[model samples]
Target chain A: MNIEEMTSMERVLATLCHEEPDRVPFFLLLTTQGADVFNVSIKEYFSKPEMVAEAQIKMQQKYGHDCYYPFYYASLELEAWGSESVFYPDAPPNAGRPVIKEFEDILSLETPDVFESPGLQKVLKTTEIMKKHSGEDIPIISVVMSPFSLASMQMGFENYLDLIYDDLDRFKELMRINESFCVQWANAQIEAGATAICYFDPVSSSTIIPPELYRKTGFRVAKRTISNINGPTATHMASGRCLPIVDDIAETGTAVICTSVLEDLSEIKTACKGKLSVLGNLNGIEMRHWSPQQTEDKVKEAISKAAEGGGYILSDNHGEIPYTVPQEVLTDISRSVKKWGQYQG
Target chain B: MEFEDTLLSLNRVAAKNIISSEFTGDNAFEVINEIISPTLERIGELWAHGEIALSQEYMASRICEELVETILPADAPSRKNMPVIGITTLRDEHMLGKRILSSFLKANGFNLFDYGDMGPESIVQKVKDDGIEVLMVSTLMLNLAHEVKKLRSSFDNEKIDTKIIVGGAPFLFDRNLWKEVGADSMAVDATESVEKIHEVLGDAR
Candidate 1:
């Protein structure tokens, strides 16, 4: 069957099941770029659920990708801990400052009610709006940060490392708090109509931590959190290389894993065969400057490497598409995927 | 106290004792160059190869930073004088790389203006205002890495002769990114930044 014969929902479901779909599924991960499509400032777009839903629908219609990621930004998760996000006119919002200034602050930190946090509520509302609009046709991909990764943002990365070395018990205590909040927030999104959760956990990546450390700390947090997610989960390291710890990632029981541009797609596909589906490896950093031809070439290359046997979703290695990418580049990706992403019996 | 082992094990007390006992005033630079710099470099290599975790490398760098400050303060009389240098993370909040690079340079007796985290426009103005001859920019994200081009354009528009050197994950991922962004050179790690600085400055040092 041609890709046109299948709904985006069916296509993604098929790929997740490790069955050949009409064609390879792809997600553009238009997180911040959705604001540009909606013609609103990022701060405004994130605040208004209707606009975010409308923008995501418009982006899906424009690019014809298979997934709807109703995400605002990573920093929104940190907001539940009283961390503020700094909005930029031309860039995605960044976490302002470390909320946990001193190590002792972790002792008083509490797991926030996801429903009460304004930023998180906005995300949940956006997910609900998208599900209401395109629930039956598109797969809504919601995101939740791993407690290990969130610990870095709660305190500065350096401070987090210091905490780990200074007081392992406090670090673990902080992780417990973050894990509770993550589970609550993730289940809330599932209740809000998300089909699957993308667990964004860059701190666990080999780019940040070695496999042994991940096995000792991040792996345990992921395993416990994922088991309680109440929905399918895809592990993503946000462009951080995962090959070194791919086995540990698979052991987390996530249904899918997003590979980084730093690793070979074929190697990851081979490593993940029969274990977890793979989605991505495209270099989002360089995609902005790529010509349509270059974009198509990359799409074909990724498809040729990982799309066989139907366990892959073509996407940029980084979970979020930068706003700097030109519309033509995205258009070319959509066109190229449809043209070259078809599977043979 | 095994300084290298203590650094790797993230043992701050042992590292401090070793530094205090071995780092006399005259041997400050020698101690850093021979022991601390190489140890950190080895840790960086271990991280690059996935032998040790980033937490190890980070804590090691932090420990070294604290100890090095006591031995060789930024305003020490032994600071270099010729070419004015500056480093900053343009529009990026990830300061580990920048911090590591700054401490490494300071350990090597180079006096550089640490601009912390600033955007392209402010960074450009500061570069011009300080008459910085060599600027090192570190960025963790790709979008912020492109800001180097903006800084370079501003420098050219203002005719500032400051040579730009960039290092970070983005530059490491894309080998030719430094050249594309109009950088004078690129360093793979903090250790290389010192060599690149000397290379970019030539006899200006």
Candidate 2:
């Protein structure tokens, strides 16, 4: 494979297809951090789709990462359900208070049109803008929250868990409602020009739930949602451990699985061998303090473990990189990937 | 009714029945300290080991909280002389850790002021105004966990002697994070929080 001639989109696509790209593709997953790059507050960054698009392009160009996305934050999805978000000067916005204050509220819940919801509209518009600017060179990875994960934000996390154990039927009913919105929103992003859909579902992580509960709930929901998505899909657990359910995640039909830092990269690669492509395990929490040399060492290690097989994408373990991580470290990561991610004949 | 099994399975009715039939006002504290606390600890262990789902641990804690509230006498004199403790989610809204710890502390007859969610400045101000001796801060994200360092500095500037205890995913992920964030101690779960408070407040309490 002549790696230098490959575009970022081709590089990522080649990897997803289990073929050697020019080099191992790397994604920064710079979501809220784009605000910092754009020199705007997080609140202001999400307000304008143009700003988000421009920031994403700038970030990819600056870091030389293979992919960029239009995700602002997970809570942005909750806005469609009438939940307000609390923005910060530094961090990503969090869902203010749960919309469903009581169990009965789920009955009256209506799935809002994705095109009509302001937050969802902004994401779709951002995707369209990125598509227009980047064209087919760079891949635009759009994100959609899995129904089970979004349930925690819809109601309180504890309340959602309570609903699961307290009234399994009601919880399933809630998941049904959330699944509709997820499908609509995911398809809308695809129509807007997303290269692939990243199904963000942290709740299904073995760290959060046992595999049995996941098979009964999140697994079913994800399989159905991914089947309905218009584009290829990657299952992301937002840095939650997925080794116990790696097989189940592969069974969900996603093209790739974004693993967690909590698990060993070599083990993850071995588990994902032929079932799915792997995209992560870098410790985002520790990335903030890594020296340039340390960052390079980490990158080299990840490539050595997973990149040789030709089905890996280097990225921070958590879906989104923290805004606190220094620019120098990110640059080092991209440089190191280019240096050591080459495939030998 | 098997109290531990009832809480584990999340059978609230069975749990309530056990409390009504087996628990009396006199044995309330003993029941909480002996039966309820240990059962929740086992559940926490199961959760930490990935043996049970988080929902089971959370619902178990919730059920235990309800049972504790029902059995414990509200006007118990032991609640008055305990340290003035305050808990809050520092700049992050993920409340499972805070809620669980708050309930666990309250069940132990500690006077706790649940500050729901607040920024660093508000938290500092509240800590000073409430004269909280031991402040427990819970944050689910790493950046928010970093807020504890800023909070610690604020407390220092104000010359407040409140000892800070942090518990959350970040602290658990990074074992030394508590000390790095200037917290006096870090508790892995609610059960450990009680012991940490005792250790943090030593002779001063």
Candidate 3:
């Protein structure tokens, strides 16, 4: 086969090594749309592990992105630890009530066993299913939110942050507990057939907290889980605030740092060098309202700035492609990338 | 015992020091308006300018909430027949922004019922049942525009007269989105929300 049609796994591996792949790799932190591809109700799709796996496979086959991120976040590690939550067909899950209603509750909470938890089991099962269906050449990115983001779900997002300020000791303790779970779960996903672990770490982003404090708490603990993982780790921070901390996060040994649409690509390109792959940085919000020509223009611009040295992949900013993105607009992105992201060598 | 000291203590995340002031409930509202208000705005500005982390700003909000709850009167003499208003995040979750909106509306003396996180049916049913004069919907995700539109269609079908107000990141990013989704008005922040609520309830000064 021609270099233009390299497998996604080859494409990703090439980009990681800072080599010129046939074309720029594409990353989609895709979920939610799985239901649409399978023509199943969102409720039916999210509830069954097989249906979920099927949805992800269909999406992978259809989108043909370099890295297939198949994640359905329902507060996995936190739910295992007794955090109350409810998931809807339309959106992500949230805490039904704060698990640690009082600061003292953190002291008594113990991390659940990876083998014995429903949430962990579901994640493992999904990975196994995806691995079975995805050929050897396809790279499956197992999605794991960082300890800090999961901690936000355990208590309320705001309450979790307030506790960080209100009681640093307790917050550290919580991080210790949550990080332990993340390590177990991430390794479990790896064992169950994941090629790479894509961790969502938005809570530590500059959008939510300062780099100094994030480095102290969420970033520090989140890094603990990633550092312990075996191989090919990708970390995603979805807020524009992630810009200021790119160097620090890159220092954490993540192979890829999927930034949101707000990053300055020139700064990221300069900062990342050969250390990490810069995926995403697509303006997912604004693109949802843009014309097809505008979408193509954005794809071309992102490629020109970030794809030059080879450690780059084009992608939608954070989360799924925007709700308003038509299939045609997505096609525009893929077409634009193929046209502009060619390797000269 | 001044409000600003307590809030400043909270700003520093000194949780206990905020309570040491020991003001009564009636006194709590006064300090919240005069002292906590500007401090919260400053905190917003800091977050906006990237001086503080997003999580730290959230911590400030949660701090302001805990401090204010101590002073929220169990029974502030209702504006006798003040128009009752309800607030919720349509469909999914985003509690802080809506919580801030509810707190501001309550401070302004509009009868408020916070529905927390709920789907369209529950929100519309409550507005219809409680005779909520204004239904305030706050959502962060762009997809939630459908939920807002659904609520509007429900209101129209039921012939409910309650005013609808929408806010959050999406509406703020695209000003026309609020109108397109069928909301009656939109606010940029808690303070502007209070003014919008006043206008919606026909109590604008």
Candidate 4:
């Protein structure tokens, strides 16, 4: 079989199966440090379509990553609802506006419009750029904020939790608005040629909310949004506490599940079973700070545990290291994949 | 009866936070002062009854820093007759109990020289150079608790008479840790911590 003629899906499937691909595919989510490493700013990368295209190509060439996300995070959609953001030189822009100044503010929030809103349009333009250069050679995955998280952005993180107890209806209304925004954002990305949508709900993780509330408010919205998306959809809850909700998340029509530092990989795979792909639980912090060999060991261990079937993707579970993770370490990980990622079963 | 009632209330609050995960910030100071402090007065009631789990109590002390974020005053307090206090945590520790204490002392009309998260050497230098009237060090983890003793011994070595006040989860629970550290005194909570400082200042004056 000619691997070159196979679609991006086929290439990804081959790699997932631990089979020799046309080449090993690597994923880059154009984070701030990632953009800086490629000599581009967030503004420059997002503003000029060609700049984004050039950076994506450069990052792919520079790191030889299999998957590429054009932009880093989905919280930019929060700006559509009149929320504020604080940008940093090296971090994902953080929401500055507390969405819920008062409990009453939730009732007045309208569902954000992705097509017309400025922030959403920026992402839309970025997605368009991603589609143009993707050349059907690789998948361009995009992310969306979960409803509960977007609600936190709308009402502010601390205030949203406080308001949940004081007022449930208004909180539910805000959640509905957040859900609408997620759908709107997902649809826009799909229109702009996002191959798969990645839903990231850090707030829905157990550290912030209890398990019952997660299943009740956040899980349902996440499920519905993934089901509504046209192509493959994956959702990531960045805390281990979300482990209990893994089965529930699988039922949400996601093709993939990603988690952060605090999850047991085997359990996540077991929970999702045959329903979805299990991406990663490699400690990103370790990769960033450890020696190249240590980083390779972590990658090897993660692959050993996660690579039983052709469903696991070797990647970090959280934010990329600023300057610490050596390019050589990443190369070593990739080389090890080619060396060790054979499906014996 | 009053003292018993306060202890009962404090226990109830502590239990609610631990068991049900219900955090009530309302009247938190009163709960800490009227109940938590008085309960601590009962020899070793806090550690004995396990009202303070190692993690939760340490976290509670850290949350005191959050209170500072919310309770920033519009204008700085007057420096007249204010005591100068130096606060630091042990090396590489991120627990914010010392930070919280510094914030409160500054808010309550004390001039603070906050060395932030520092080693014993850094803390001693700050105390000496800043002419700090009281040297306050806090640690949460058991390993970093040794730095308190090192700070006190270093001050003794220099013959620099600085009042040492140690408070945090580790010092509060580990009864022998205070004597081992050779620090002048210790307090279990922010309210008693302030009172201890006042007593030290009165003696100095």
Best by DockQ: 2
TM-score of model 2's chain A:
0.98
Model 3 spans > 4 angstroms off: A1-5, A47-51, A77-79, A82-98, A132-136, A285-290, A322-325, B1-39, B49-51, B59-85, B103-111, B124-133, B141-145, B157-160, B169-176, B191-204
The TM-score that candidate 3 achieves is 0.83
- Which is the better candidate, 1 or 4, if ranked by lDDT? 1
**Cα lDDT tens digits for candidate 3, A276-323:** 888778866666577878887888888888888689988876755653
Q: What is the C-alpha RMSD of each candidate to the true structure, in Å?
A: 2.9, 2.7, 4.2, 10.4
Q: Write the per-residue lDDT of candidate 1 for residues B1-205, one digit (tens) a residue.
A: 3677898766789888887888778777777878887877777777666567666777677778788888988777666563677999986888878877776676566767899888778887888788788999999877788889999898889888899999988787678889888899999877677678889888634
Q: What TM-score should be assigned to candidate 2?
A: 0.92
**TM-score between candidate 1 and the true structure:** 0.91
Candidate 4: regions farther than 4 A off:
A2-8, A14-26, A319-324, B1-205
Q: What is candidate 1's lDDT per residue for A1-345, written digit by digit as tens?
A: 565589998899888888899899999999888778767888888888878888888999999999888888888988888888888876678887889999999899888999899888888888899898885899999999899898888887877766766788998899899989999999999999999999999888888876777888899999999999999999998888888788888889898999888789999999989989998978887887889899989999999999988899999988988888889999999999989998874
Instruction: State which docking tier applies to candidate 4.
Output: incorrect
Which residue pairs collide in model 3, if any?
Answer: A206-A241, A207-A241, A208-B53, A208-B54, A208-B55, A209-B53, A209-B54, A209-B55, A210-B53
Tens digits of per-residue lDDT for model 2, A1-345: 466789999889888888888888999999887777767788888999999999999988888888878988988898888889988776777888889999998888888889889888999889999999989999999999998899999888888877876698789789889999999999999999999999999999987777888999899999988888888999999878899999999998898999887788899889998889999979887887889899989999999889876889999888888887888888888889889987663
The lDDT of model 2 is: 0.85
- For residues B51-158, could you state the per-residue lDDT of candidate 4 as single tens digits? 332222323333333333333322333244557777776652333356446544543445677776778876777677888888787775444666777887889898
**For candidate 4, lDDT tens digit of each residue in A1-345?**
765555555667764454545543335343554555557665454455455556666666666566657654445676777766655444455555465678876667677667777766666677787677775766877778777776656664335555654477887777777777788788788888887777877666654455566777677777776677777776766433456566777777776777655557777666666666777766543454456677667767777676665567767764233333456766676676655654442
